[model samples]
Target: MAEGALFEFLCRMGDNTLVLGHRVSEWCGHAPVLEEDIALANTALDLIGQTQMWLGLAGEVEGKGRSADDLAMLRDAWDFRNVLLAEQPNGDFGQTMMRQFLFDAWHVEMLAALTRSSDARIAAIAAKAVKEAAYHVERSGDTVIGLGDGTTESHRRMQAALDLLWPYVGEMFLPDAVDAAMAEAGVAPDPASLRPAFDARIGAVMAAATLTIPEDDFAHKGGKSGFRHSEHLGHMLTEMQWLQRAYPGASW
Candidate 1:
């Protein structure tokens, strides 16, 4: 039971990184500016690297015949455990930045806490990932501030972007049964515990961006804890899983 719980937790982490990384990778050539394009691509590469580590750890923990590649490429859309925020369509440049800003802030806090996990391998992975995530958060926050406080059009677009993505943001804080069990075992941090820190960081960024937080009283939820995802995820999985599905046991 412990191992099963651990595997589930690890898969959740891996899937989140993998899906978000792929989403970000979509901007590799299409960013509004050249410098921003490079920045987004770099962030995507970092996330992809993080996914490799987490998925490899998950494979080891599962002690199954399945490898990281098999798990990542063979999984269906419904089988993915990433939050809806990560899989949401990249609406515009501002929209992408808003999504990244929210996700990176939460990710930084989660990785920092996970660095102290009781599980040695998990701790090591978190320790390494925390550095990467910290930079990602900083860069994303800077972009949000830049665009939000820039020209009138930029400001309006950024505000709209924030509103569109806010509904999905709640899922990052939603705790699941696996999370609860891991918290009890000192293998994971409570999602709720990270909220204050995440809020503070996000607030600071919004302030710097000269933007107001959305006043939506009712926040949408349920994506990571097994709720259905946006329509985008199905298309993403179809492309991502095609190779493995088409050529069973195919290898490099």
Candidate 2:
């Protein structure tokens, strides 16, 4: 039971990175500038690489024949455990940056805490991942601050994006049974325990950007439970899993 719970927790972490990486990858050719285009792609690659590590570890823990590729390429949207925030549509540049910033802030905090996990595999992965996540926080936070405090139009759009994405943020800190088990085992940090630091980091960014943090505590959940997901995830899977679905066992 403990192993199963750890596997699930790892998958949830991988799914979050995989789904969000795919979302960010969508900007590869469409970013507003060449520098940003490269930046987003680099960030996407970092996230996808992290997903590989976490999901690979999960497959090992499950003692199943499934490889990381099998898990990532074969899962249906309902089986994915990524948060809704990661699956949200990148409505605009501002929205994308806001979403990225929000996730990055929490991600860095989570990874830092996970580096001390009793599970050596998880700890090693988190230790390496926290470095990339710190850079991600810096990149996204800078973008948010720049755009949020920029011209009138930019500022308005940044605020709007924050408001739109805030509700989803609460889900990041909400602890469920799986989290409780992992935390108890010292395999994972308690989600609630990470919230204070997350809040402090994100609040500092928003304050610097002159943007208002949403006041509501209401959160939408379901993704971590592997039972619900945004409509965007289905479409995303169509593209991400197409090659594997179309050509079983085929590889480059």
Give the winner by lDDT. 2
> How many residue pairs collide in each prediction?
0, 0
lDDT of 2 by residue, 1-252 (tens): 477788889999999999999999999999999999999999999999999999999898889788999999998988788898999988999999999999998899899989999989899999999999999999899999999989999999999999999999999999999999998888888899989988898888889899999888899888788777868889999999999999998898
lDDT of residue 39 for candidate 2 = 95
Clashing pairs in 1: none
lDDT computed for candidate 2: 0.92
Clashing residue pairs, backbone N/CA/C < 3 A, model 2: none
Poorly placed runs, candidate 1 (over 4 Å) = none
Q: Give the Å shift of residue 186 in candidate 2.
A: 0.5
- Candidate 1, residues 68-105, lDDT tens digits: the string is 88789987877777888888888888888899999999
Superposed on all Cα atoms, model 2 deviates from the true structure by an RMSD in Å of 0.9
For candidate 1, the clash count comes to 0
Residue 78 of candidate 1: its Cα lDDT? Answer: 71
Off by over 4 Å in 2: none
TM-score for all models, in order of appearance: 0.95, 0.98
Among all windows of 10 consecutive residues in model 2, the one with the lowest summed lDDT is 223-232
